[model samples]
Target: MSLVLLLFVLSKGFKGSRVRDVRVRGFGTGGVDTWQTTPSVGWSRIVPKFHAAIVKFDIAYPYGKKHEEYTKLSAAGRGSPELLVAEVGVKDYGDMENMDLAERFGVTKEDFPKVKFFVNGKDKPFDFDGEFNAEELKKFIRRHSEVYIGLEGCLETFDRIVDRFMTTENQSDKKGLLRKAEDEWDKLKSPSDQQIAETYVKIMRKVLEKGGEFISLEKTRVEGLMIGRITKEKKEEMQGRLNVLKSFTHDEL
Candidate 1:
């Protein structure tokens, strides 16, 4: 979808001009790579040579006001049929703040409004704990490629049981699909979508008990999530860890 990235996503944000970071980096065999403010290497070697990259590391100043609002949210966070949402300011790596590229990407300085999801040839990179807008970072890169709406009424059985529980590699094929997703969330029947499909099978059974630190626990807000409603001191501050996951906002969006 190039026509200058479909006119930069129908021009919802940009005050363009001057130098480096109007951005572009899409390589499926060297295709659209541009935007570089002195990076002859080092984003852990240019993010595994891109096939996915969501970096939004800021420190502002290049176009002010948090660098033109994260460069118009990385040009409306591109069209993502794979990924590439870059917008790295950090004062273009000068004024003594690169700190050896933030200690070779372990990130501190309070995780400077972080967002790093790179996945090209993988070298361990994933921590976009959602919500810092840009439409939840384009619904977390389209939930790494669509499928997330289940209450019954199969949608390719929860996206083929989350791509066979993130590409199985044994462990009894990941506990036999975590007991076939708790037997399809016990054949739901809308008791609040069977408690939201048992909180999406308890966050994919804690990502199969944390064996592969995540690629898809998949909750890109399928069908606009809901959590009844809160505020009784946020439901008595979540009535004793009501199974710990919470993010509810419904004012008619």
Candidate 2:
């Protein structure tokens, strides 16, 4: 869909909702592209362009909450060359334009806000059954495809180390990955990145000293701190820690 039409639909759909104004101010300015006429363009033209494409099938007039959630996901995916975030706005009224396109994907008006991830070279797209949260959806994409969608507070480099650390049963190999993480930590210049890097390194050391169980124990500890009457800054710090901790435990979808 054209940007103008997408805005028109959102403006018409959201009407009195709290998100309407927020969405109108700045939403699709991020990487979210909208398509009202997918049939003409064809999946053949679209699917081949990226490693994976996350497409939302919803009515031209959609639920406000879903639209808001999708916009957030799109923002997260901005500048990611490996992924395409898009929405197809179907019209089920009047001539029911785009309804035929929706049916081609097994979607109906009742399930308006359906999401699917179409991986390049795949015959079938994967259905997203998780919550509408951007972080959860990013994890979903990461699990299904080789594409890396970095979560907030999670460093891409340390994430790779974590993956290597968890997969190997060899103590020596795990220790080597830990040392490598420390080396990478030393090279980082940003104080904020260093802080996040330190958490990854700390978690790695703790895991080595204790065991894999340290991850769950530490996550619980951080979650406890989050629930306390902490300042906003402290809460955000704790949340960042929590995000890094999640990278250690997120399993394949």
Candidate 3:
């Protein structure tokens, strides 16, 4: 997102126009259900209308001409705007349209190196308003787009788990919850239940040594499930794992 945000900032500061040419780079039905957005848009809408757009612009007057950095921004785009936009839902048009662009975004000539997002092309474009980087853009997009994007494979799975477990404050002294979590984890039979148990087990192994954050986190994981029964073997296995986990090294952690 930083590279993308940088490309946009440069594209606008250097280019003498707005990015309107870069159109829909992909079409898919996957994100809608996951994000709970509007129904799958047709290819026609995805190309230019529904897809995210980055409309950039250069500064005004002779000074704008003297220091415009569009070339540098274009260099970044030369690699492939399509690839960057793939998961980001962004398309760097590289200052395509020259429509009094700065004014349209409510900025003045001083804000030359500006970046605004026309997410889904419905609302008025919004300014990114911070560091021109990927991480920032990702957080911005996660907030604006309401989509959990940018992670892949194991990291992606971890992201989802964290979303479920992330807590800002410490938890109360909920005694004996670890045993309760273990009981629930044992009774779960569905694939998702098993997955949650697996994550709970992984995090639980460090329960005795980790910080309050981990404590709050594990409590959250346990709290997400309802109480349930446990088998004798499962309880024994849990105890055995706890015994081994007591000696976990930093590398093992």
Candidate 4:
């Protein structure tokens, strides 16, 4: 999709999608695009406040359906041994909240987060020893890459089957060889690694079911991902500098 169209889609969210009530000010003044996305009343109105109580959450709108595709792409697998590719498309870097934790705090492994949600707050127990929460991971999709969360999951069966056909154990086609290697990696991991692999497997299955490989799916993939990225520290710093609409107030909205 064209960059202009992508910006249009992202702007719609800034105006307010179901889970978020957002607004933009001072954007396009100095050749820079800036905006804020805040949760709507529903988030805070939920007795305990979903935003605060929950370590992570997302507001699902028609636009947010891109994430469903992310889950699918992440789990994708090629039936043939010739190809085993998993590519993640980051949304827009500027819009992602966890870039701080994902990058600065060292959570992302390559493109994926090592640990997604930290229960009991970052300061409470401060546990950084586990797998990522899928739902929470969605929040960090870079918001800039049309396909920020894309990944490929391969099964040991797939590689073993390919291995059987190769005249020499390591002599399969380059792509096919990589598939076997990935499968080997999967086998030697702890339960956490296995879970992550399986999550990708499930997502890939879903994508295949929906005919996700079709060009039509790219439209959804490319939406709302044209913004530029600012560092997590910079984002917080900017939020403080600019008086964007705040989600909380003493008076009722």
**lDDT at residue 124 of model 4 (Cα atoms):** 29
For 1-253, candidate 4 gives per-residue lDDT tens digits of 3222333443444444444333221112123233444433221222121111112222212124433433332333112111111111222245654243234334343534222222212322122222343322322321211122222222334323322322233333533544554565478657745654443333333333443342234323323222237667655433321211110110100
Candidate order by decreasing lDDT = 2, 1, 3, 4
* lDDT by residue for model 2 (115-203), tens: 88899857589999888878889899999988887888888999999988988999999999999999999999999999999999999
Error of 4 at 14 (Å): 37
**Where is model 3 more than 4 Å wrong at Cα?**
1-48, 58-99, 151-154, 167-253
Off by more than 4 A, model 2: 1-41, 61-63
Whole-model Cα lDDT of every candidate shown, in order: 0.47, 0.75, 0.38, 0.30
Point to the candidate with the largest TM-score: 2
lDDT by residue for model 1 (1-253), tens: 6423533343323324332332333322223334333233334344444466666655543334543444454555343334555545454344544444544567665677566766664756677775565545544554553412211212335446655666666777767776886788789676755555565466566766774443222223321223546556544433322212221111101
By lDDT, the best candidate is 2
> Candidates ranked by TM-score, best first?
2, 3, 1, 4
What are the models' TM-scores?
0.28, 0.84, 0.36, 0.18
Residue 85 of model 4: what lDDT? 17
Q: Considering summed lDDT, which 10 consecutive residues are worst modelled in model 2?
A: 18-27
TM-score of 2: 0.84
Root-mean-square deviation (CA) per prediction? 16.8, 7.4, 15.9, 21.7
